[model samples]
Target: MRIVADTGRCVGAGQCVLTAPDIFDQDEDEGTVVLRTAQVSGDALERVRQAVHICPSQALSLCED
Candidate 1:
């Protein structure tokens, strides 16, 4: 699975970063969600899922393709 982030929809909540810092980060300027990497490892999927669910703006998703 891969992580997908829509920065335009982000509210700079930082929930993604808190849940999965290894895969998600915040842009320094705007503090919006930023993808550290789109590729998600098996072990990191759990954390990514939590991040997606907890995100206030719902800007993150998983792409199975």
Candidate 2:
């Protein structure tokens, strides 16, 4: 699985960070989603999804490949 953040829509509210800090981070100066990894463990999928769901700007997307 891959986690992709649509930075164009990212407001960097840090919801993703709160959900999965290992997968997501914010560039405080830029207020953007910083993807820590394109690939993630199956165990982390649900948390990643939660982050995507909680993203106020709908900036996060998970792609299973």
Best by TM-score: 1
Q: In candidate 1, what residue range of length 10 has the lowest lDDT sum?
A: 34-43
lDDT tens string, model 1, 1-65? 98889999999999888888888888999999888899887889999999989988889999897
Alpha-carbon RMSD to native, per candidate? 0.8, 1.0
* TM-score of decoy 2: 0.90
Cα TM-score per model:
0.94, 0.90
Which residues of candidate 2, in runs, are more than 4 Å off? none
What C-alpha lDDT values do all the predictions have?
Answer: 0.89, 0.86
lDDT of 2 by residue, 1-65 (tens): 88888999998788998999898888878979898888987778889988888889998887878
Residue 60, model 2: lDDT of 83
